[model samples]
Target: MEDDIYHVVREPEFTALFLLGADDLVETVEDVDAELRLPDGTRWSASFMTLGAVETVMNRWRETGEYGGGVFFRCSDLVIVPKGGVPAMIEAFRAIVADGPQETLGNLG
Candidate 1:
């Protein structure tokens, strides 16, 4: 993907921009980094990873001798979504911010 490639999804209370690690085809993207900005200037960030993507990473780690031989997976700000694509990730983010806990995301500013 080109450096200028990005997807933006706006909501009533916030705007989400799918930034780094995004693919040209959003639907086929298995993992991506995004930023969520609230009306109050609060910024939050999280890496969105699908279940299959996480498993793939873990398997790769198991072969490369990383993360205790892929015994576990952890990230400071990770949002695991059931499906790929920016839309699904945005949905998950919305739910997380609406009904989930603050720990689900990392504060950017």
Candidate 2:
């Protein structure tokens, strides 16, 4: 069975969140340029992620019909723009990817 966990982590400029779900090992930083935009109104271009994170995002899409276009991605405890109000979600995910956190790792498994 797949264990899915969802929660929000509020920050000064970003909303850090995580979601875990069933299927596949997503072990790679994915460039979700087509799915998200940067602060300057540009596509997000980078591959920063883990296997578990990718699985979580994919699972969310399959179940909720969200981010179906592959524009956004979830990385363990890092969710970029879940509510879609602020532009800081992208930056938050980047920061977490650069520096692994206990919270992020906790959701990996």
Candidate 3:
């Protein structure tokens, strides 16, 4: 993970910065771990995973004997999106934020 490189996107209400991995391609990335700065100067973190990406990870975990043999998928600060790419993720985050469900993301101190 290259912490220095970030994909910054500014929305009307918030600004999001995604940490890109060494081999990550922004246009095709299905899973992203991002930090969002809200209007109140508060930062929140969330992991956005597409349905397909979650299934793929679970299947791989089954083979590797992880996460109860891949029977269940759990993430503390997870926002599962229907599609891949950063745009979809940013949209989801925006929706979640606008809907007043801050619990969907973890607050960063």
TM-score of each: 0.84, 0.22, 0.89
lDDT of 3 by residue, 6-97 (tens): 88888889988998777777777888899988878988998988889899999999999999999999999988888878888888888888
**Candidate 2 TM-score versus the reference:** 0.22
In candidate 3, stretches whose alpha carbon ends up further than 4 angstroms from where it belongs are: 1-4
RMSD of each: 2.9, 14.2, 2.4
Per-residue lDDT of candidate 1, residues 1-109 (tens digit): 4235667888986888887452346776777888888888888888888899999999999999999999999988998888888778878877977874366888888
- Tens-place lDDT per residue, model 2, 36-90, is 2223333222233435546667776777877875556644433433332223434
Q: Indicate which candidate wins on TM-score.
A: 3
- Prediction 1 global C-alpha lDDT: 0.81
Report the lDDT of model 1 for residue 40. Answer: 83
User: After TM-score superposition, what is the CA distance of residue 41 in candidate 1 from its true location, in Å?
Assistant: 0.3
Superposition-based RMSD of candidate 3 using all C-alpha atoms, in angstroms: 2.4
Model 3 residue 85 distance off true place after TM-score fit, in angstroms: 0.6
lDDT of 1 at 36: 82
